[model samples]
Target: MTSTPGNSTEKRQFHGDLIQLRGDRAAKAIWRRVPLASAGSENSIDEVALQEMLFRHADILALGEIDPAYRNSVPVCMELGTRAGAADALYLTPTGRIVLAEFKLWRNPEARREVVGQILDYARVLGSWSYDDLDREVRNRTQRSPCDIVSEAHSEVEEHIFIDNVARRLKRGEFLLLIIGDGIREGVRDIVAYVQEHSGLRFNLALIEAAVFRRGDGEDLIIQPRVLARTELVPRTVLVRKTILEETDDDPLEEHEPSPIEDENERFWRAVLEDFAFDDPEPEVPQPSRYGSVWVKVDGSGFGGWGLSFGAFLNRSQSGMGIYFTWRTGFPEEERVFDEIVGALSSNEELGSRLEGWKRWSAPSGPPRLGFSRNVEFVDGTTIRDFDEAVGWMREKFNRLVSVLHPECWRRLRAKG
Candidate 1:
């Protein structure tokens, strides 16, 4: 019969349900619920459904009684196992129970005894072969083995073949026996208990009560498995919280020393001055007879003290200029003094107007300030070709200014000369 999606009888069986049994209790309860008649009466239910239930859950069944023919045909009912072995082969009896059939051997005068012994032997062999081995065997039969199946270290191919070859000898040791008709047959229960104890196996026996419900011209066997008791308990819940905060702050302010380049440059200039003093020869004492007065104009802006003497010698014979000294102040204090002189000149407007352009020198980050002074008429700004003239002018001024400010400096200069 054609069936709609999700409309199968199996799907309709359990829907919108919550099983509250915990762990093993759930497994045991489900086992007990299998209808006794359904388990015992092989022809009463659908074999496919029975196989599906057993294979899906790997459940063991207990049979109270079963049709001899169905029982003989299906000894151990397993859906996955039968399907794996023979995909197209139907291994179910007219009754719902799965039929397990295999060829066997017997060589004894006592036919029944030998058959029973052979059946036991077959059962032992089938039991020994694991599910993995059975799957491989099925794959081989279907010519669908991807690669040659390798045997496990402890596996024996002979055992698998032996199990398959025996038919009637095969028996379901602790398999559920379905007892059809009135009540369970006493012999069936004895066989079940015997198999359970002697076969060294375990099974869950499902006792189903079946009654024929007759209504007018219709009669049907109603089968129902006893409902196993169960209890439900709620699980505890846990709460968790996580929080993180980040902070950033500026570093505390601190004072830092001046750059190293400035320090090195200062040291270099001091060394140059010291070397110049060492190289120059001592000056001869002046004779009173040849003494002459010469006015040296010093400019203190460009070079230091040395430029003053040089400028004086260059302008010695100049008519009105005589020996003009020009120099620039290098220290802030010295610059202040020069500024005062400039201020004084400014107070006297006559002298202030006579003064030429002055260049104030200052270091980039330091406090020291300096300026050069010179006579505008004698030293023509147009005629002064390069930095040398400016240097000479500043040096001359430095020497004169130093002499005036500290006479001791003048004495030292003369002594060095």
Candidate 2:
């Protein structure tokens, strides 16, 4: 069966509307939470809360804060002794009046030495953990044997040994350090500058500022530090650079063109028109609806002719026994012309006999009544077979009528080779 152009256009329009509706719904859903603040009125976010947020949004926390559960879960190995405890612990050392913390196992051993040196500098200037008794305790804690642990004569040397081991780990890049306090401490800045100049190791540092308020009732309002890091502000430009590099490496040698279906509908329509012009002409036709009237006009003049009116066809009966030609009544002169032409065609003995036989077989009975009013009208005639056959007959009769009315136009059309 042939496809109607109108059907294709209607389908395309329906699909376009569906796409637009879906896009509008998606836009509404995505922007719905824009007005709300993500975090509460807390002045600072603690390690626990930070860790939870990091876990929830894994992509953003690729190598940041340590979760408490993760830190305490590390297995203890007796071979390392007390050093095993240090390996598992997330330590916060005093950097002047502020605290500089390192999350457990965040970096390698090489990087750990750099962190320890910075922490030592911070401790020296802050004067919080002096190299006296606490230093001796730290050394005793690290020693493997009882003699080494009890030896207090060279407390300075023992302290150096313990600190040196930590320093070596920091140098090997073994952990991550987070600076947490009210504001930037001089000691922290000095150590940061020192690390930047001496060690080329890249470290991510978060500066946290907190506010504490005490009321007369002895209630303390603790405002936590708001974490700030360079990574959170914008997307990484390095990703874009890498993408460009990859795309450039796999560049194609040649470009391909799109298929004909990708062209616009208008272009397809133009092509179809061109094809039609270059080929044989298609026959003119008329179609009939299921329930319609059929009216045939027969002129008894020498050139006997027959004409059908759609209005009369529809008025015959609301069944498959008539044809309805609505355009006939609207153009009376054209109708008269068509009637004269059909009269001539029907005068042909063979054609007229076939027409009469078709009418006799399909004619409706009784005094023809108007099936409906206004839009619905009946014709004093008979139908023939289905709508398709009726349409074919009507088209032949119409072409004959056109030849009689405008002989010159018909001749001109036929002359085109």
Over 209-325, each residue of candidate 1 has an lDDT whose tens digit, in order, gives 222222223333323222121111111111235532221111111212212322322232233233232111232111111011212222332244333322122111121111222
Segments of candidate 2 deviating more than 4 angstroms: 1-171, 185-198, 201-203, 230-417
lDDT of 2 by residue, 278-335 (tens): 1112322222211122222322211222222222222222323222221223444444
lDDT value for candidate 2? 0.29
Go through the candidates in order and give each one's C-alpha lDDT: 0.29, 0.29
Please give the distance, in angstroms, between residue 345's alpha carbon in candidate 1 and its true position after superposition. Answer: 84
